[model samples]
Target chain A: MADRSSKRRTLRLKTPISAEDIADFRLGDVVYLDGLIYTGREGVYKRVVDEGAELPVDPAQVGNVNFHCSPAAAVREDGSYNVGAVTATASFRFAKWLDRWFEISGCKVIIGKGGMTSEAYRKHLVPQGAVYLTTVGYGTGALLGRGIKRVVAAHWLEDLGIAQAMWVFEVENFGPFLVESDLQGNSLFERANAEVAKNLDALYEGLKPPVMSRYGETDDRKDELI
Target chain B: MISTQTLQNVAEELMAKAAIEIPDDYLAGVKGMAETEEGDLSAFVLRAMLENYEAAKEDRRAMCADTGVPRWFVKLGNEARIEGGPVALEAALRRATASATHEIPLRPNRVHPLWRTDHNNNVGLNAPEIDYSFEPEANWIDLTAVHKGGLFGTDYRMLFPGDGIDGIKRFLLDTLIAFGKRGLACQPAIVGIGLGGSKDTCMVLGKQAACLRTVGNRNPDPRIAALEMELKDLGNSIGMGAMGFVGSSMVIDCHIEAGFTHTGGMPMSVHAFCLSSRRATARVHADGGIDYRTDPKWFTPYMRRETVEWQTDPASGARSA
Candidate 1:
């Protein structure tokens, strides 16, 4: 394990990541970030993409990195904020909003849990020159929280509430994310899944099928539920 | 009588402990898995998780940002009495949940399903579900807080008696492989299997088996215990590990809880308590003394009584009513 991990490359890139910076990134490379990143998911996506609500903060001002997350946060009585452990949500569910989101937000990096499919990367992210970095452990929330230097602002707290609100953060060394998808749409998870799938059929060799079967989206074990 | 104040205070502390601390049994299990994990990426993930636990403890913050849907499991001693009745107990639990959500600054994950309303607190309609059980010959209440992730790695099926163990294995593999991909289910988990119950009961038992029981603990029934070991080995044998990488760390432990069911049907459910595996328990004595611990010790002999009457001597295992 150590030998394999030793061979993997690690990098740290600043926010508003450039095409040149991410172009050489390979699937499974470790990455850390420095500068501003904002949180947005279903609520923010619906408000801006579907409901036509203008973004409360300009994308250029906040930088182009978007995190699919909500912080364990609270607002103090003095109208200040207390932001604790920060972790990512599954990014697959937001694939639908990606195209429009990229158009509106100019996001160049997507940090989240469970990287999107390679197809999603090719269609939605490749054109925008964006890449996906997944949080380590599907989290490392407390470590990530320690990386946060300050909460720049939180928008839509009244309307969307804390979980759904858009939060902009100032961060430094803010990740231990793995590069799940690269510029050419190659995905680390898909590669891993393919290798694991090779041994799957043999595991069920003698296990007979159930007497009763229910309707499902797919019966293929190799296929992902996402 | 236990005062509502003590209950509320203990409940609040349990909430924080559940969110911030990785219980010892689970931590030890993961450490063992990490040592043996061969997949490079999987090993890296395990190492990172270990570090994250230390970070959480040092910083006094939640181990996972998605803090999961907070819920309570209360065990009341047959002789235990609260200053107020069940209604007041419920209120105290709710108040503690709300207060801790703000204090621990837990992410308010609960919402009004259709309307999408957020209370900025975990409290809501049927939220923070409190489950109950009773223990004989004691005068204390046990409060266990389980912060289990709400998505992926769970499934239910109605299998016939004829389906047998092979059928159960198939379903387990199916659920594990499906959600185990991309680490969606957060593999290397404590996988719990619920067998021989009605559909809802199957779901509940499976969840309790995962969240309430500690690692290395086995069911009382000898046959069930052996099956648990078999399932645990079978899960780890799947060439999958942390983050769905190819390796042998899919399950750190497996637990099964069974119930008498319909004669013709053997319903089953599978639940995965993920990498975080957040839970903490406290016993509040009638004299208002509180004792905190990691293990829930929920499945007592009396709770799993096979006969119609409570007849077993808890201390001696003798048959007496």
Candidate 2:
């Protein structure tokens, strides 16, 4: 048995767990992780790469990487955990710089919502042996439920707030999520979109309104509440 | 005495319960259509609807509470894989959502022809909403579970939850224009306008607007944020009630994304909101796996039921008391 109780794991880089190890993780499976990972999102990443300052992280300790947007924006002087829900947002603007994010953080798994586009998935993902995945959308509260504590990198807190906070946490489980994009460049975005278009076209062509609509002949619309 | 945590839990349990209780108003709309429409096509539509209702009833779920807004935007990662069936994603979504509606016994909000009726569950204009955005990630996919808020008109609320929001639309609209004007930081040019409902339908346009794919940020530049800030103030000034009558933040927080204006045209729209803001999310790994990524730091057990009970005062409701 893995003696699940006593293992102390720090937030590390995105570790390359084989398909065998990772496949076991389900949409709602909880797992304690042990590895090195860097933490950076929008503003956090900007400070590190843009400022060219001494890395707040101990390069030797970082194993993998984690990314989230709009994390806790305010710094609490008392050191009590500042709770928040996080999700990946608007990565299109940063695609050009994505490869660098991976290289710097050595992240194998980048978690975000909305499947990525084709070009970015292929060029940046496959060659690097990286993978991408999606979670249910707007599930903020349920998603935020997993945060256990704050393992602050000390100085990093001063530098980053919402976009750059380096707060590592112990997650309960990785959930009942599905893969939309893969190392081979397959994408859910393209597939889901095609289905939408097809459905829309069918709806437009098939349904027609009756000469006398059901809600009565009068068009007393303006006064109605929304 | 409901704390934020208690409120959240109540929001989840009772609201989810309400979702299951299919309202007569919605089902009535669907039933009314089944006997009237003519032709094989009508039959086809009727059959599809039957299946949807069946799934909802059997599973005790909602037909389509527009889970898409949360599912498409919240907990998603870079990739997603659906293996259960060859059924198209959209088709499966419709079926699943329909199942949810029927099971939850939620009111069917979909209606026909411009007059939106809560017949059965077929509200017009794709009553269910979904939004999307680009994302990046490792192998683990993310799934966002959301408890969305609903804004119904003040009237006909007893008839259906969808009806309560109608009474507040005027105040809401007035607030939107005020936000874009000199009163707020809103710059007329780069706005994404959302006009809900066809002047007549009981359908909710504002809630739909909130679910719409945004044109851009409510504030990209300082000018935009300033406009948003000003609007917030002015909107409250009108004294719109709790549902915008006595006045609250009429536009909520004008979230700004980035967008370009067409010449001098100031674009803006009214966005309605679901009340709960109930949603959840999780993530998948590189090999097509997931980590039900709940931020443990915030997950308190308070949401769960307790043995103790509290008393309520005569204040009935002191405005969110």
DockQ for candidate 1 = 0.72
Q: Residue pairs in steric clash, candidate 1?
A: none
Q: What is candidate 1's CA lDDT for residue B291?
A: 96
- After superposition, the stretches of candidate 2 with alpha carbons farther than 4 Å from their true spots are A1-38, A72-77, A147-155, A206-226, B1-321
Model 1 collision count:
0
Q: Could you tell me the lDDT of residue B148 within candidate 1?
A: 94
Per-residue CA lDDT of model 2 for B1-321, tens digit only, reads 112222223223333433333333323433443444332222222333334444444544433333223222222233444344223433433444444433333333344446423334322356444333323332233333333432222111111123222222333343343332211211111112232223322223223223321222233236645655554444333332111111122333333222232342222234333222223333434443334321211111121112364223213232110
The per-model lDDT (C-alpha) reads 0.91, 0.36
- A57-168, model 1: which lDDT tens digit per residue? 9999998999999999999999999988999999999999999999999998999999999999999999989999999886799999999999999999888898889999
**TM-score, one value per model:** 0.97, 0.38
